[model samples]
Target chain A: AQSVAQPEDQVNVAEGNPLTVKCTYSVSGNPYLFWYVQYPNRGLQFLLKYITGDNLVKGSYGFEAEFNKSQTSFHLKKPSALVSDSALYFCAVRDIYRGSTLGRLYFGRGTQLTVWP
Target chain B: DVKVTQSSRYLVKRTGEKVFLECVQDMDHENMFWYRQDPGLGLRLIYFSYDVKMKEKGDIPEGYSVSREKKERFSLILESASTNQTSMYLCASSPPGYNSYEQYFGPGTRLTVT
Candidate 1:
């Protein structure tokens, strides 16, 4: 079974300051990690994913994440925060071998990021 | 562009009534999924269908059923609607492959069962 953990329920940052949202995972095999964002009364939108390759992966809306194998973490980062970026973020993981099984997704509780002006 | 459409943005129903939530995908993807989202729980899968007329149970399948009469349409049925079933229901679809292709989602239907 695979599982994802989002350590923070809410994160606050001033506009123009760097921001980070932490995520960790526990899976038997190599993990297919993803980040999604949801706006108020809207569906979730894909942000980025980390399958393999460079540790650092760039995503939409000026967001990026660094995959740390040793730490078992995939933390989302932004060079500078924007007030418009405030929304709910989710971290999800899937086992490499399990394709699209019922247990494919192990999502975090979600993190509400608020970028203040 | 891949487009997934949900039949309703909001629905209200009474207990014991049968409810059907419809979803359609235009990408001709082989896989369609139903998920329910609640506060603090993120998203939990209710059911999935890989092909037409082929359905599989998901993490939380109790009190829920699915039908895939066509490749592009997947419907979720609540046998007997209950207040516990009230939540935001999301429909998603993805291509059949090994690579990590992101699942396209519908706007979601917020069902309120009373």
Candidate 2:
């Protein structure tokens, strides 16, 4: 089964400092990885996805994630943290090989990121 | 902009009551899904329908059921609402034949079972 794990329950970072939210995935064949963010009382917003190509993929709100196949990880990163960036982050994996499971996303437990001033 | 809309933003119900949460998408999407979000747990898929009259169970589909009679509408039903069923229910839709498989989500319905 395809799955992803977000080890940290919460990550705290100071404003102007770089921040990272860790994610590791396991899938059959090649993986389709994704990162999504959810603000207070809002549905999740897609941050980025790693379908193919570059190891490092840029996403919305100046965020980027590196798809490290060797490490089985796709960690979200930002050069600088902002107070508004604080939210819940989720990592998901999907099986591209068709059948009944097509387009179904298996999500991680989620990590709450807090950026302090 | 692609739009996915839900029936209610918030709903309160008593235990054992029947409940329905509806979702409609305007982008002619062929896929619609139902997910429940809880603290710590990001989003758990409950049910998904790829087209009218076809449904598939997700990782957690117990105590929940879904209907997709129309192309654009999907409905989630809780036969007997329980306290454990209280959660933020989300609906999503995705266009078919897209390489990215990017899904558009609705704002969600917060359901509270008393």
Candidate 3:
């Protein structure tokens, strides 16, 4: 089974400060990780993904995530936080079910981020 | 731009009523998925279709069914709407092979069962 965990239910950060929303996962074989952001009443927007190679992956809206195989973690990061950055964040892992061609994703519970001015 | 549109943004229904949630994607992707979003559950897959008339059960498929008569359209059906089944439903489509790693999502439909 493949699953992602977001320990924090909510994270608060000041404007211009670096922020991180932690995520950890468990999966068989190589892991494929992704991050997405959702604003109120809107669908989730893809942020970034980590398949292989470089540990750091940059994504939309000045956001990035570090994929650590040893730690089984893919934590979302941003150097500067803005008030508008407040939204819901989700971490997901790709699961290619054995004997199946279609790919499936397992997502974490989600993290509510609040960036204050 | 890859556009995935749902039939409605919000809906209200009575228990035991049959409901249909439609999703159409213009990207011509080979895979389409349905998921329910709850506050603490994040997103749980309900069903997915990789080709016309071909569907697969997902992590949570009880009380729900799916249809894919055409390449670009995927529909979710609730045989009997229950209060506990009320949720925000999301539809997504992804290309085949390598690019399938990412999925494009629709605006989502919020369903309320009373």
- Give the winner by DockQ: 3
Clashing pairs in 2: none
Q: Residue A32 deviation, candidate 2, in Å?
A: 0.6
Return the candidate ranking by lDDT, descending: 3, 2, 1
lDDT of 3 by residue, A3-117 (tens): 9999999999999999999999999889999999999999989999999899999999999999988899999999999999999999999988556666888999999999999
lDDT of 3 by residue, B1-114 (tens): 889999999999999999999999999899999999999999999999888999889989999999999999999999999999999999999987744799899999999999
Q: Pairing residues by index, what is the TM-score of model 2? A: 0.96
Write the residue-wise lDDT of candidate 1 on A1-107 in tens digits. 88999999999999999999999999787778999999988888999999889999999999999999999999999999999999999999965324544235667
Structure candidate 3, residue pairs in collision = none
Across all models, the iRMS values in order are 2.5, 2.1, 1.1
lDDT of 1: 0.90
> In model 3, which regions exceed 4 Å deviation?
none
**Superposition error at B70 for model 3 (Å):** 0.4
Instruction: Compute DockQ for each candidate against the true complex.
Output: 0.54, 0.59, 0.79
What class would a CAPRI assessor give candidate 1's docking? medium
Deviation in Å, model 1, residue A15 alpha carbon: 0.9
Residue A11 in candidate 2, Cα distance off native in Å? 0.5
For candidate 3, give the docking quality class from DockQ: medium
